[model samples]
Target: MSEARNTFGKTSITQKSKKLQPRVDLTAMVSVSFLLIVFFMLSSFLSRSNAMDFGMPDKRHIDCGTEPYCLGEDRLYTVLVGINKIVCYEGNRLDFSNETRSFKFNDNLLIKEMISKNQFLKNFYGDKKGLIVIIKPSKESNYGNLVDVLDEMAIVKVPTYAVVDITPEEEKLLADK
Candidate 1:
């Protein structure tokens, strides 16, 4: 917006001068702004978001003692997710009695335990593949527990892992606890 003012300062009768008004053109500014918007819109990429790497095992390779050297109880680490509690076991079995331990979620006892176990196994066996985690979410568990266990697995850097269903014996043991 602009205003024009005309001034008459001691003008002579024979000589008179016309006052000129300044004009500002908004067309160039508007066009430049529009062009910039168009450029940004065209330069932007519209693509799908990346998914988290869950590291799912291949079904074709899974063998429950159908082949030799299959994943056994000692090499496998089972993480049972429950309401505000976590139960972890290491072995080739899911009997829920051998080497089973429980921890509350508040102190991240599960992750700390997992880290210690991984470190111990790494130092003892000298093999990263020695620690395979089998995440078993019981009926008492929720999605948050599952997610937390997975996050802990990532933090602990477990080499092999999977999410499996709970067995009846395991459910009975969980109820007893």
Candidate 2:
């Protein structure tokens, strides 16, 4: 609201002088400011990114003799993620005869197995980095199981690991369990 007042007592023609104070309406500006704040807050919260970092094998052929990072059969640790159980084995071959060990997703046995294998490698190779984990999630396994396995790898501080496609033989092994 603006008020008008007579600044001068009288004008030359006996007319009173008037002065009006300026008024500014800031209701729209304040509303827009609040709306913008809310919009930015929501956008920032929704746009936040969540991710996990892991190495992927190179597409090109890698020679074990030449490449220092090349994984050998003795250092290979394969994990098969199933619907209710996780099967793990050390070495390149997936031998169910005696090597394949199964553990439930909720149990810490898988973590123990990984740690033991990592320790075994560290002891045998006398190297700081040795274990190379390869995760194969079956179709029956959910995304959560895969995430859990990756988390276990992180927990164990495994030097190298990768998520790979499951082969038909491995899938059959999982189904037989």
Candidate 3:
């Protein structure tokens, strides 16, 4: 009886020694991670598409054609778009010295402030009937950033607009062209 019990225990030990290593299945995890990456990429693309695009008006628009816009009291507003600042002027000549820097439009607060200001400008100018807003952007500025500024201007309901202060002197000398 003892020998039979010993033989059974030895067989049990032999079976236990031939154990298989535990393996983790990474196939499902890899697939899920890949799907998540693809989803994020697609979502980013879609969000970019929703961003506003503002293109500079053609030179023809600035010409004023047959009937030129009148420059009168309460009729024209000048806007200056600098590298890191935006300021509004009451007339053609903007005073950078006494400039109201705090009220200037910035990338962070541009949209919110511009929308409210547009409503104000619309009513402000509508009281007088007609107005022209001129935009002056720096030469080194990015076109897209310029458009962002213009989009804000448009949101404020600025009717007639123009772009000036671009450096033709530098553009003509560019070797890349």
Q: Which candidate number has the best TM-score?
A: 2
Ten contiguous residues with the weakest lDDT in model 1: 60-69
lDDT of 3: 0.56
lDDT ranking from best to worst? 2, 1, 3
| Evaluation by TM-score, superior candidate among 1 and 2 | 2
Model 3 segments beyond 4 Å from truth?
1-69, 95-131, 166-177
Measured against the true structure, the TM-scores of the candidates, in listed sequence, are 0.64, 0.66, 0.42
> Residue 140 in candidate 2 has what lDDT?
90
Could you give me the TM-score of model 1 versus the true structure? 0.64
RMSD per candidate (Å) reads 10.1, 7.5, 12.0
Clashes of 2: 0
Report lDDT (CA) for all predictions: 0.74, 0.84, 0.56
lDDT of residue 37 for candidate 2? 100
lDDT of 1 by residue, 1-177 (tens): 799566556555676578889899999999999999988887674444554587655556455565423755566777777777777677646653687788877777777777787788788888745578888789878888888888888888888788877777777656666
